[model samples]
Target chain A: MKYSMEDIARFAEGDMDGDERAEFEKVLQADIDLKSGLASYQNIHSSLKMKLSNDDKDKDFKQTLDEVSADYFKQKSKVIPITRYLAWTSAIAAVFVLFLIWSPWQKDLYRQYADTEMIAMVERGENSAALDMQQAANAFNKKDFSVAKATLENVIGAEPGNATARYYYAISLIETGDGAKARIFFSELYKGTSVFKYDAAFYTALSFIKEKNTKSAIVWLRKIPADAAKYDESRELLNKLK
Target chain B: MLKKLHEDHRYIEALLHNDKKVVQEIYAKFAGKIKRYIINNSGSESDAADILQEALIDIYQQARHKAFQLTCPFEPFLLLVCKRKWLNELKKKSVLQVTNIDDALLTIGEDVFADAELLEKQEAEAKHFEQMFEKLGERCKEIISESLKGDAQEMVAEKLGVTYGYLRKKKSECMAALIQLINKN
Candidate 1:
């Protein structure tokens, strides 16, 4: 039996009397195509409900959201200046410091255990990594230490309370021969109960070593607790440093 | 006993009421990560803005039509939908997938995936209905759009210069024509 538009419309609008509605429901049970056809009509009926409900309000909301979002992104994407010469000089000094500090055998050991937590840069949906922090991590992983250092500085400068970026920024600082500043940043991490606490202590020792300060390096290395993930590596490094 | 709603339901409420403060807070809270994801995946800032706005509209539509409830955090759900939508857009534009698109975006759960799947379905259905709606004759389109919107049928009939019974009959016929169009497709 063919269902009229009136039948579908009345059902959609709840305009059908009880006996008629009940009769239609019974027919709906018996006829799948008719039921599905009515369902399609209902879909249009409901879909239009929203498009007609104070269209101006929704249009305004969307317009405001678009403007606000565009403004926010514009503010965020502004590029800060990078002093290339200083970055290059720091890179050169860091390499020289590493060359002087380690023999080939110990360099291999440094290679063996210098592993930090894997820095993931592309935060797809909702992990807590900030934009500058992710950019820094990307630079660091690509061995672009100078870019990493500059970006990390911006991140830490803008958000000093970000313990994770501070820890990584310290490493970036050390990579760029700013061991003095790196060591201080790492100290803040080690003193806290952050996820990077023990790792920070170990890296702090490495920063001191880069500065040729064996005494401070030894002090930071010993701060690594036995339960820390890097304890054994710390001991190994401490033996060589001492 | 009544169950307590999730705190993140405020996000849905914010969209439903178009509360400016809550919407601004949403941008401040979540837009950065989505923008970064888009840019890193070879999309521009403009692309990110468009995708995000569309995603919010999809969410609003779902909330209004289906009474969307947030049982999980808003972050994963919003991101998951936005990321998927951007990827689809990229594919449609035939952009080369230079990077591992899956790994670049934030990871979410099966539930979030399910929510996104449901959202996509709802959107597809809306598009289908809308396209079929556009196929209707001008008067039928006008009568249906105006009449179905909770306006009195008699007033609509008078405005369209038709008898009340004629309006009802024409509306029925238009709706039936629409149903036929939908079934044909």
Candidate 2:
């Protein structure tokens, strides 16, 4: 009816033969105290085993997070490779073109044209809609009307309600030789609810800059908020208008 | 291997100090073994990933103090350390709560203290298993890995490109051979 401590330890370890294990269970059935002791031993052993097991799991999880983080960095670095390749190609192209043009006057003109084209290329290179709109604004500054208009349209295509893109797109049009089309786009950009409302108003005035309308540029520049980051630049450009 | 593990201790220390490359190397190095240990225990694939990461951190701490003197190969010491950590976590979760904290702490007896020395012996057992695994042909390793997926004989057989009947027989024979090899140690 009773089981020994040695029998209990062996059973807990699961080391006993099947017949002995069955016999020990039968003995445990008859004795409550023996059953309790066996249960305690089994539970403790199981708990330790479980603890060891979870420890293994936690270690594994940390390793996985590390792996995932590494993967993220690898993916980010992959994006930079194409960008670097394009830059190198452009540098090589510039060097080759420079060697072909021997006249100083022709080379200087070519260099200026290349500089403008490179700026246009960089502006068009930005894939982000917001960045495209910013680049469109830069092209408008350089008086590259057609490229600026096309880039702004691309930006607005991605973000239909982008007031800044619309305003810049309109300005590019008006300067490039489409006053009527510019007016409609500018009117729509101004009417819309947008973060670039002030820019929209300012560009409305600049649309007339193509017609040598210094009076309108001054009015629009003055309408720009004094607190806006671009207000100073607008003021300087407005001063040059007269 | 122990020497390599001890050397990796420096790498692990660098990881703890936020060296990104070393952390990546450590992750690549031990992730599989840690995953196996977790999967062998009562945990999911995701749990395995979690356990390995924390264990590495613990090892990192030990390495920082130069306390993780590798007397055995990295895998077993890592397995043991992680096992201990998981057991502690299971206790906290009370998933299979048997004894309370007081009784559990009190149960840390002389034998438990002897575990420090037994670690090296356990490492020998692990190395023995590793040696046996290496001795096994590639097909045997594949069979074991497939069999471990679950005991659905038909499914395992289909996955392993064998008939169910042959698969079962091969599995039993392989398992028996593996047991004998382990027993010989």
Candidate 3:
């Protein structure tokens, strides 16, 4: 005899009276389909209950996991052991001392002032652009500049007016040793009215500094207004350059 | 038969409680190896982070719902889980040229493999169940969700402005419908 879903549900939920439940159990022993249906129902029922009870806690756990994961990857990319540094320092100590004395101001000024930390890309919504922007931000923040450059290129192609993307793309270009191309984008951003205006100007100067163009570096640094975002850093760089 | 819980069960408990310090230790200790494995397998560091995080969340869900106990070292168990997940991800992306790792190198016990497989199965079922639940009709969704709140049936019925009998009847039908949906898939 085929039983209805209600009968299966009642039996699974323990809602059936003793006699009805006994009769259902007798059928359940004989009916394979009914038993499977009851099992599925019970599984779903329990899973739903677990989900309802722990959804908020699950979200909290995911948040904590994301935080720790980001920090782990970030530190992995950035930190160098002191032993490794000391090994390299000893190997190159004499040559470095000679170069440092020969050109004290010619030290890697780009490395000194190029803040490669990309601004946090706020996910405005679930759109593709926001997701791409986020991926670019993650790659950039993790110092994976090649991946960042490629993703940012696509983002720039899709949204030409995204100054954030433009700014970071330029930085990634510089990071990947294409400072010439980076300077072009940085120059464009510096002349625009985006929030990255003076910030772009500062990086443009750093790109020039990276190329050892002290003259162009000084030119770009002087363009940053005193009230601009990179004004203090730019002035310090300028002082050293002068 | 109840299996003996390993000392590493503390890691599972830490996940259940969202203990940041312990979770951070898990990352600090295990993340580098996983990251290296992923990078060697045509995957990026970002992919490694995602896979590791997902594996942990899967373990967390299994522990929360199924009383999953760690009966082996957490390192090998987590590595196996993350490796399986990354393999699945690579398959999904249709990425060729995967460098497969020898399972023998992991030195995972038979029981740990079985437990990881069971946890993966349960995680898939939970996801599929959630998808099937979404396909339920509006009234069915509301009734099932409300009824599962562990409230007294009469209270739930009153809150929904329905008779207790109606609530029970509708909840059963809704669950039946959900089961049918899941089976159809």
What is every candidate's C-alpha DockQ against the true complex, given to 2 decimals? 0.21, 0.03, 0.20
Better of 1 and 2 by DockQ: 1
The C-alpha stretches of model 1 lying farther than 4 A from their native spots are A1-5, A14-39, A51-54, A75-242, B1-7, B104-107
- DockQ, prediction 2: 0.03
Provide TM-scores for the models: 0.55, 0.27, 0.57
lDDT of 3 by residue, A1-242 (tens): 47887778867766678888888888888888888877777777777766655555777787667545654553323222223343565457546544553466756777666645564333223346556777887788678999989998887787675666788899999999999898889888767654567888898888888888999999999999875657877888899899
**lDDT score for candidate 1 against the true structure:** 0.70
Estimate, for each residue in B1-185, the C-alpha lDDT of model 3 and write its tens digit: 88999999999999999997788778867887888799889988778888898899878877887788988888888998998898899899998777757744466788678778877888778778888898888899888888777778899999999998888788888888888788789
**Candidate 3 residue runs with Cα over 4 Å from true position:** A1-4, A11-40, A49-54, A75-242, B103-106, B149-161, B181-185
Candidate 3: CAPRI quality band: incorrect
lDDT of each: 0.70, 0.53, 0.77
Candidate 3 versus truth, CA RMSD in Å, comes to: 16.0
Name the lDDT value of residue A173 in candidate 3: 93
Candidate 1 residue pairs that clash = A124-B105, A124-B106, A125-B106
lDDT of 2 by residue, A24-85 (tens): 88887788888876765443333222222334334443443443332212221212222335
Stretches of candidate 2 above 4 Å error?
A1-144, A147-159, A162-168, A190-196, A240-242, B1-185
Q: What is the lDDT of residue A232 in candidate 1?
A: 80
